[model samples]
Target: MRVSGLILPWAFLLATALFAVGLYWALWVAPPDFRQGDGARIMFVHVPAAALSIGVYAVMAAASVTALIWRHPVSDLTAKSCAPVGAAFTLIALITGSIWGKPMWGAWWVWDARLTAELILLFFYLGYMALWNAVEDQTTAARAAAILCCVGSVSALLSKYSVNFWNTLHQPASLSVDKAEHVHDAFYLPLLVMMGAFYAYFMAFLLLGVRKEIRARRIRNLRGALAREAGA
Candidate 1:
């Protein structure tokens, strides 16, 4: 908590700075796509949000695995904290993708493979969080939620590979590890900056969320103890 308190402000500041630079670069500095024109600018927001939606779920799944196997004290909290954040990112990705899609695809949405997979991922996040609330015992809730998260890992995988596995309206990744020349410098650099800003924002939000979960757990424990004492 103490360490997070010190780092949170810096994380927020960094995210703010990067967002300002990234938006300016993406909106003004980068050339409008000959094909999409200014509409392409939406990718500046959509791409990062889409990436983080999957990335954050991956983090939650990893934490869930750790919590289930090792029973690490903070691992469950970390997974729980990631749920709403991941869901928010997924929602942003969906909305932005639809907005970008309208101009390109002639519709606000389609049942494309990648889009369907992403929607499923959002459902997984919702179900995982719902499982936590449905169970009364904290231990049971954590175990169930962890299992759900691990099982939901398949959705994340599908989301990443759906474009490759099937023909879809959604385009393949703009950047790639194997492909050196994916996008031009102007678009690539600003996209990178935006991704960094989103990551920094995630870190700040995650830290704050974990701290809140810890405090809530502590209060629950105290209340349980008080009830036991009263019963005795």
Candidate 2:
């Protein structure tokens, strides 16, 4: 393999361990929210998922750029590999956000900036996948999808900042990028664990998906070569 194969398995193991630690801290060690009580526990997963959705989108964008710039087959495969995972993360974020909203905001859905932008992102993902399927040629499909991926990345950025750019039902960022706070070390430690777990999950899935795509491509090449030899 051109990539670090060992890293994926190690990442999977590390992620599992982190997830276990995070769950323990969130459920047992960290104190419940003064306001939301036990319900606040949901944030442990929701926030991480939401953040990851955006982060993965950024990765997809970078991969798309590489695919177009370097014309690297692996880059295209990696970009294509990320779509489903990104979509899954986005779905998880939306569902958890809705659930959190119902208890906190008294509504299941809203046309707020963040929510609207996120929904648009979901559509963009679907559209990009559809475009890939519509094209018959792999090169053509990769180019088209790369464009769509790059263009669609705008929505991903907007999704992250929508809460701040406009008034929205979604809460602002949990940990400020600008300022630091004395978050209870217990809570911070677990938050790190969960974040690491989520990242590992992304890597595990992305690597597996790319590996499958590479295998299929190799098979196609072999079949084409055999057919050519027979014809000759």
RMSD of each: 1.2, 1.8
lDDT of 2 at 18: 82
Q: What value of lDDT does candidate 1 attain over all alpha carbons?
A: 0.94
After TM-score superposition, the amount by which residue 70's alpha carbon in candidate 1 deviates from its true location, in angstroms, is 0.3
Worst ten in a row by lDDT for model 1: 177-186
Q: Which lDDT tens digits does candidate 1 get at residues 85-197?
A: 99999999999999999989999999999999999999999999999999999999999999999999999999989989998889989877755746777788899999999
- Name model 1 segments beyond 4 Å from true: 179-181
- lDDT of the candidates, in the order given: 0.94, 0.84
Among all candidates shown, the one with the greatest lDDT: 1
Task: Please list the residue runs of candidate 2 whose C-alpha ends up more than 4 Å from where it truly belongs after superposition.
Answer: 178-186
TM-score of 1: 0.96
Candidate 1 contains a number of clashing pairs equal to 0
Model 1 clash pairs are none
The candidate maximizing TM-score is 1
